[model samples]
Target: MFRRTFWFTSGVAAGVWATTKVNRKLKQLTPESLAAAAANKAVEAGHRLKDRAVGFALDVRANMAQREAELEDALGLHADPELPPARRHAAIENRNKPKSYVIDRTTHTHNRNEDH
Candidate 1:
């Protein structure tokens, strides 16, 4: 009689466990849950693809810059860009000469080209 009672209790516990597990699995199989899972996976894939594309673009930019530097070096076009270009427009002696100005009392004006 004791063995019969123990077997009955065990059978009920097993059935309850199986029922709960099956219900949980059924909930996961519903359409809304499946759609949410798929959307989450797609978003993850999109993020990975975007990261790869960004890395590829960065690599291409670096290569382009390296190639440009190589071409500039090969063509002998590299020069310092910070210094101002020298333009010798005036003679060396004329640069230091001062202009004379004469103030005339008749007109109350200063003439630059008149002899003092």
Candidate 2:
């Protein structure tokens, strides 16, 4: 029984010594040091994000210019033919069509009634 008690006490002492060493090493890894490392990583990430955003903006501009050129080319192929002088003269007469209106007092009265 005495030998067992001695072995247990020695084991407890060794454990306490090991724990102290581990605690000392952990203390070296301070919150301030950890926070600075985190800040540096964040700054690097932000720089990468800014670079990606600029690249995307440049790509969008390139695509837009290509799309515009394609549309202009398509429109050129379907150009309208010039109208003959007689047809042009007759078309001008059609533009002077008489305009007429019926007084919509009923609609106005209905709108007012709905408002009330």
Alpha carbon lDDT of each predicted model: 0.89, 0.80
lDDT of 2 by residue, 1-116 (tens): 99999999999999999999999878758898788878999999999999999999999999997997799688874334584333323344454555644456766565545654
Model 1, poorest ten-residue lDDT window? Answer: 94-103
lDDT over C-alpha atoms for residue 34 of model 1: 100
Candidate 1 residues lying further than 4 Å off, grouped into runs, are 81-116
lDDT by residue (tens digit), candidate 1, 4-34:
9999999999999999999999999999999
Pairs clashing within candidate 2:
none
Q: Top TM-score: which candidate number?
A: 1
Residue 65 local lDDT, model 2? 72
Q: How many clashing pairs in candidate 2?
A: 0
Q: What lDDT does model 1 reach?
A: 0.89
